[model samples]
Target: MLEPQPTRSEAAARPELTREMLEMVFDHVENGIYLVDGQGVTLAVNRTYEEMSGFTNVQLVGRRLDEMVGPDNLFSGSASLLVLQRKGPVTATYSTSTGRKLLVKGRPIFGDWGEIRYVINTIWDLTVVQYSQKIDADTARSQMLSEEDIITCSEKMMSVVDLALRVAQTDSTLLLSGESGVGKSLLAKLVHRSSERRAKPLMQINCGAIPESLIESELFGYEPGAFTGADRRGKPGLFEMAQGGTVFLDEISELPLHLQSKLLGVIQDRSFMKIGGREPMTVDVRIIAATNRELMDLVRQGRFREDLFYRLNVVPIKLPPLRERRDDIPLLVRYFADKFNRRHRCYKQLSDELVQRLQSLPWQGNIRELENLVERLIVTTAEEIITPADAQLEPQEPELDPDATLGEMMARQERTIILSAWKKHRTTRRIAAALGISQASAARKLKRALESDIGAENQS
Candidate 1:
């Protein structure tokens, strides 16, 4: 099916015309095109690129890409410059003077002598495609993280887990804020386990558990003869020791103000000096800090540094308390019971009625308290089928709020109904339809319910 070739005279006459036609086609192509020589000098660019970048071919053609990167430069940086530096293909995000976000892929072509001849940069508007792709990817990743023994059925908690997994994909500092036993430590481990640095050590230190005097020496290693009773060989700090992994600083709110300042510097610079060492030691470590107390409150009270709090709060992940995620209670109970049963080599089961009762009771201490209660029951009860009375522990009765009026109680009940429906359906329209109310009313009630819960927690 080969086509007839053009005569030599015909081809010769149209060579220049064909080249011009091809160039015209390139200018009209949808994807942005940028071509640069080996020395990073822009050689040719299509109209699509000129339009996308707001940089005309006349201004770009003769200039070096590196010259266009700086405080007063047209570009933040050039992908072609990266291609030149790496001597290979590279992918980057670039921003133009017009504030358009470009996702660029730069490929370098080498000459026969192994020297780069030219670089071709292909670009597209990132907001047009990548933004939606990122959301889809994040949703898929969140589902995977949820499947990893997290044992949560609540959409709210699933969202939290998804966020944690997304942050885990980066080396950015993470701050986990929640009440005690809300599984901050567990989430911290999950982040570490799911991170690029998972192969390395996941060093954990309890800021609250460590003594103040020794904490500095322990965190920032001390040199020999720097302090009395020091070992002859200096010890590396936790940051230094975890060179390529994560350092989970549990109860970070308990970190002294002075130490918090030092932690901030380490986080910002990726370097820290030992307690007694003269030179600053650089470390390639990720910091994952967890706190049972509210760090913002500590900052407001002057017990924590505001600068340090901001540094650690780059990716703040707030964990929902067990009471808020009551849907997970039954799954957790079954998981713990099975775990204890295997450990003790005993066969036991929880009755449906007892499980329901446990789900209804407020788990004030959260997962840790629930686990302990389960283990205690598993070890003490001899019966194969355990009852609520046989467990020998009563649920902590809620204190009566005598200040509340009957109308207020009714409002609280109504709020609960809306919240439960919203949590299950996750859409205002669906929730409203299920509850036989207008979507706007459902949304307003749901917002108030959430705000009320937060207010109650803050008050507590």
Candidate 2:
């Protein structure tokens, strides 16, 4: 028997759900779902529809999708919907009104006549998962963007960050070794947060920041009668406070040699005495130590305990400095811009020239320095746009010979210029005032350089 005739196009059209009809359908969807007609009106939406998005039925019903996205939406402003106009489907991860993440997928839907009638779109909330991922990514990105993703891009830094993640997954002790501000502390914190001990308290202390006299009590705590001004009740040390968690020891190289013996004992035996207590107390905790200074160097200098250094250097994770990964600068700068923008309540656009300047500058201070400079720019710059002028880079005059090394010639030129100024001013203090350096340091460096030159001449 012949199949029933195909339904006619007009009735098959089902009047093609107006953007309004689609909106009503979208409103009921637990997930963010919406339909935009060819003319781009909200055909229908469910109750959840209006709740998640800030728009009301009145504001959204008859409006164009582009207009609905409005001024602040970079998507509309950037002509993202126009991409749908040409491409048939557009998908992206975007931040919404709640500052939450959503996966937006835009697809062209057709009528019975095979005419493209509406763009059915769906948004899936990735707020929690994306946020968790972003935290890890943000940490990895904390290094620098160009350099940010590069941690994984390189086999070496990748191994370091990877080992950090692995060590974070366990309650094992982690040691981060690198140059000053090379992100050792960052890797330690990343390990803490990424590990099984994440929910537990994570305490950080700078061994170098405390005075040598007080270091003992600070690490092990004190009983009421233990010290001259001790409280009636004993206070817990960082290890106890970080019970079931992690304690980060920064600048471990600065830990006194004698104190290193005490610390090594704790690592080996997991036991410590509260200053006045006769009994030894033990608590389970993961330790993550960081040091920009080489413990081996301190060991060679006879200033650090070799045994303690060996104990702390277990699972050593080395972070590369910013100069080694200059490509990460742009990534780091933008991250800083976004960060400082939120902190300072200002949005500053990093201009092309400004980015170029950032690329060129000698970031001897590394990631921390770049972040500080970006925060400073956010605080001080007047225009929303950050330019080369916004960076305030100091201009250095070019020296005479092209063949001369910049390191040597710049110093020579600077000295010649400073000497001329000193002769004109007739005082070291006046010369210091002109050059913006402390008079004592200026005199010292100059004297040393002159003496070194004279010694070289004597050898010649």
Candidate 3:
């Protein structure tokens, strides 16, 4: 049986709802509510706002937003003022003197003559909800794994994160060296969020992805008519846009030698000349560079500048491959499963046997490959429980016996290497070049590996 719903007339006819009851209902709402007049004069605030901002009713009521917002004032900014200025709804994030970060959305009510009447501001505490937390190794790591999305329980990754967080406070250049899809970009973001410049923009550019002809202008701004079809009135580059924040240079090793020299100059002097501009522009930004290749090797090959390598290597942090940190695979699998379930609005679970099987494989593509596999399983699995057969993983090599002799282990490893290189390069000569060995030795070893495989198949 359904309950009868009250009509608008019936609800208005109820005189039992008094002003005191209305105030109670206002205070009981989960989100903080703030009200102000058309002129930005504070009218009233609920109790939730008081607790969230550390401001009392007496302090806020009858005051102007301009009076409460300043360096030494109660709040750093007011969304109500922005609503008044724009005569529309405004959503913004600001800090309070009490060390709380808040996200507020202010909507304006209109008068009979189309004038602004009241501004209703709803607030949510961002500090407690999103970013701010105590920095203990165990607790913080767990919280970050769930909320911050860093997801790691391995000691090696934990130590890497700790070092990155510690150096994030300073302006030292960071060199994040790791394999592709190992979360170098995510770590860079974590560093930025934990730094003093969190409020500023984090500008990122991939050196390899951008074209050689436009890479220079993309790093340093160009004047109007500097090049064909350039933006009129000039434009700001990544360095200019990332002022007072951080610039993440992804695939820094792919940066051309000439541009590398300019980048080194920027790190050395904090300034660069714009395209077709006579004056050099000064910038204040922290640089966090990432590379999948060895910069030192590029330097030796004269493809990357040695000076730039040294400048960006002030705080070098190497992230281990996924195969090395197998402990995090299960956690990552569960996280991705839940994420895709919510996204696709479906209920799915991976079988325990499937998880164990996944953990055994070499994740050559790292966390990214695992995440993609989990999403695919969640979306494509016909049943609630996804089994190993649903994964359709490629056939893997047999695991070596634990009691095998050192010589046997070496021979097996050599065979595996030769076989893997043969699959990719196909020819012994190409395999030798890829593996940095002679062509004759590659052919001999490849033949030996095939013979061993045939003998093992016969025995089986």
**Highest TM-score: which candidate?**
3
The residue-level lDDT of candidate 3 at 45 comes to 97
lDDT of 2 at 103: 44
**lDDT tens per residue, model 1, 414-449:** 877887887767889667766789989988999999
lDDT over C-alpha atoms for residue 155 of model 2: 35
Q: Estimate each model's TM-score.
A: 0.55, 0.58, 0.59
The alpha-carbon deviation from the true structure for residue 130 of candidate 2, after best TM-score superposition, in angstroms, is 21
Residue-by-residue lDDT tens digits, candidate 2, 1-460: 9967757975686667799877566566667666667766666544564565554667666666655553255222211253244434544344455554444555677778866687766655433211121212212212211111111122355456656765676666778877666777656655665566665666677887778887777677777788777766666676766667777888888888788898888899988888998989898889888887667877998989888878877787888877776655665666567657766777787787887778787675677788788888889889999888767775755647877777888777766676566565556755576578888977875676567667777999
Of candidates 3 and 1, the better by TM-score = 3
Candidate 3, 36-93: lDDT as tens digits: 9999999999999999888899999999988876556687567787677657665555
| lDDT, candidates in the order shown | 0.76, 0.65, 0.80
**Comparison by TM-score, 1 against 2, better one:** 2
Looking at candidate 1, what is the lDDT of residue 118? Answer: 98
- Ranking, TM-score, top scorer first: 3, 2, 1
Cα deviation in Å at residue 233, candidate 2?
1.7
Error of 1 at 279 (Å): 1.1
